[model samples]
Target: MNTDVDQDDCWICYRCHKKLELKQVSVLYLGGRFEVELMQCPQCKMVIINEDLALGKMLEVEKGLEDK
Candidate 1:
C-alpha cells in the first residue's frame, strides 16, 4: 500500500506539534473496534490514530475549499 505522506494533510501533533516523519497508517474501522494490527509511527513510535488523522485531513480540505 502506498503510505506517502501528504504534506498538506499531515500536521505537527498537538501534544508535540512536531512534524511526524512517518508513513500513513491504513486502517479498517469496524462497528465497535478498530482492526489495525501493527500500525506505528516511524518518528515517535506511537500507534497511529487513523480515523482522527483522516478526519483532520477532511477538515483541511473543506477549509481550503471554503477559502477559494
Candidate 2:
C-alpha cells in the first residue's frame, strides 16, 4: 500500500457521485498489467489512482517494461 494515501479517508466517485470503496483492482499501463489497491465506485466500477501510486509503483513498473 502507498503510504501517501490515507486509507481512513473516504473518497467520492467522480462519475457516480457516490462514496468510493477501497478495492484491489487490475490496471493496464504501457502494455503491462498489474493489480493495486485503490478507491473505486461500486456503482459504476470506476477506479481512482492516486498520485502516490501513479508516481511510485506504476511509474516504476512502466519504466521496467519500457526498458525491456
Candidate 3:
C-alpha cells in the first residue's frame, strides 16, 4: 500500500503537543513480538501504528503464527 504521508514529515503528539519521532518499536500480538518503524511521542512514549502495517505485515504475521 502506498501512503500519501511523507516518511520525513513531522507529526505532532495530541497528548503532549510534542513532535513525534519515527522510531523502531516492538509490537506484541498473540504472544508474539515484532519490530516495525513507527511514529512515537518522546514524552509519553506513545507509538502510532499506521493502517498499512496493521493490515498488511502484521496481519500476515498473525495469520502465519495462528497457522503454526
lDDT digits (tens) for residues 17-56 of candidate 2: 9988878878888877777777789999898777778788
Residue-wise C-alpha lDDT for candidate 1, range 1-68, written one tens digit per residue? 33334545655555555565544444444322333333444556565445654576445555766787
Q: Lowest-scoring 10 consecutive residues by lDDT in candidate 1?
A: 29-38
lDDT of 3 by residue, 1-68 (tens): 33223568888999999998877778788888767678889999997777877787778888998899
C-alpha RMSD for every candidate: 9.9, 1.8, 3.0
Q: Work out the TM-score per prediction.
A: 0.29, 0.81, 0.81
Clashes of each: 0, 0, 0
Better of 1 and 3 by lDDT: 3
Global Cα lDDT for candidate 2: 0.79
- The models' CA-based lDDT, in order, is 0.49, 0.79, 0.77
